[model samples]
Target: MALRPAPVGTGIVFTRIDQGNALLPAAYDLVSETRLGTTLRNGDGVGLAAVEHLMAALWGCEIDNLFVDIDGPEVPAMDGSAAPFVFLMECAGVVEQGASRQAVRVCRSVEVIDGDKRIALTPADDFSVDLLIDFDNPMIARQSSCFHGGSFAFKTEISRARTFGFENEVAALHAAGFALGGSLENAVVVGEDRVLNEGGLRYDNEFVRHKTLDCVGDLYLAGAPLLAHVDAHCSGHGLNNAVLRALFASDRNWKLEPVMSALPSWSETAVAAEA
Candidate 1:
């Protein structure tokens, strides 16, 4: 797949170049599946899966409008992290268009609970997340990560953290047709007592960091940048998307705010390109 710049207000959209140029908007309303990953389906029932990593890269890089051209049903899982996508975006360069940035500001807290999994969003001036996870595996007994969005390095902290799975579950996942492309080169495989990957981990707390990264991508489907403090526990794509739905179900819950001085890193490039 390839990503290209779009005009102002275009938002993020995926185009099936091989399928009659069908376009699907990357919005929560179009989300049709979120089992192991997030999937967006267009009106005609076409879908694109494994989009969380790409979405997180776009969100982190402050990319507002873009067109993704794909020829398959799922995104290429390059390195199983957002780093590859981020590198591509950087090489293509970011350019701020002549339009005001916008965001959805939360007015009240919205929460979703499915057994022990929980997710919530509360009013805040900036985007932030506090995530926690508990697994029976000793390699990842309990891990937590907190990110004050836009104030840290997404490249080093989150982009390199790969998705993890238990060694014993690899066969089942493959037999079930999930993670068909997953491997040690793209995922962190954990055994009963140690990491199966030769390269250990990018961070000691990589588990929670990657989860936090996934949460950021899932919530981006809200169709706008978010200005809210998010707290989640043992939640995956399902709960993450649920909180976004709940937050938007009520008009009183969130309101769109025009962003000022958006895309600072890309402003120079934009100006230079236009000149």
Candidate 2:
């Protein structure tokens, strides 16, 4: 993957080089489904999988314009989290153009609920997140956390947090032909009594941290950076995508901001590039 500069107002677009560099807009209208993970499909049959981690990294870093090129069906699950993506962006470098940044400022509260899961977006001065997770397994009982704007706290604390699954689910996953690339190195696995992966648990509360990480990524589908306080509980890609769809379904829910009076301050290295 490469983080190439994009024209202002282009938002974030993913290009599949294997398919003639076809472009897929990263928007709610293009979201096809959230089976094992979020998938975006374009009219031209171009699609990409597991985009939430990368999206979260970009949003957390306050990158308003970018072009991502990939040559596979799935973004490389590099180290099973967003840390590698962050490192790659750091290496490729970020550039600021003459144009300012635009964001989708939430004007009202929007929410979606399914059984015990819920996701809500509320008006806020800047992007923020509060998340909680509860699982029956002892290894991951309950965990929670919150993040304020431009914290990028998620990068060091949660970005490398791997996706997890149960041992019992593996048989069914393989039967369904999923998790073909999953392993202890790429994911955290839990048994009924303990974590199956060696050297278990990067953080005792890693479960919730990963969930918070996913929210940051999924909410980026709003088509721009957002100024909303999001709260979620035990929500996955499906619920996150549903909340975005609901937000887009009604004009009363949200509106686009075309002008940006300020751009986020780039790092010293990135600032030099802009100069």
Clashes of each: 1, 0
The most accurate candidate by TM-score is 1
TM-scores for candidates 1 onward, in order: 0.93, 0.89
The number of clashing residue pairs in model 2 is: 0
Off by over 4 Å in 1: 174-182, 261-275
* RMSD vs true structure, all candidates: 2.8, 3.1
Q: For candidate 2, write residues 1-275 as lDDT tens digits.
A: 66677776677888998899989877867888787777889998789988888887776666767778889897777766777777777666666656556667788899999999999999986778889888888788888888764735766786878778888897678889977755677778788898888898888887887888888888888888777899999889999999888888888888777544444443211211221
lDDT of 1 by residue, 1-275 (tens): 87877787888889988888889888988888998799999889888998898888888878888888899988888877898888777777778677777789999999999999999999998889999999999999999998885714777688878888888899788888876754787889999999988879889999999998899889988887799999999999989998998998999999998865544643312111210
Q: Best-fitting candidate, measured by lDDT?
A: 1
Q: After superposition, how far is residue 120 of candidate 1 from its true place, in Å?
A: 0.6
Pull out the clashing pairs in model 1. Answer: 101-259
Worst 10-residue lDDT window for candidate 2 reads 266-275
lDDT of 1 at 31: 85
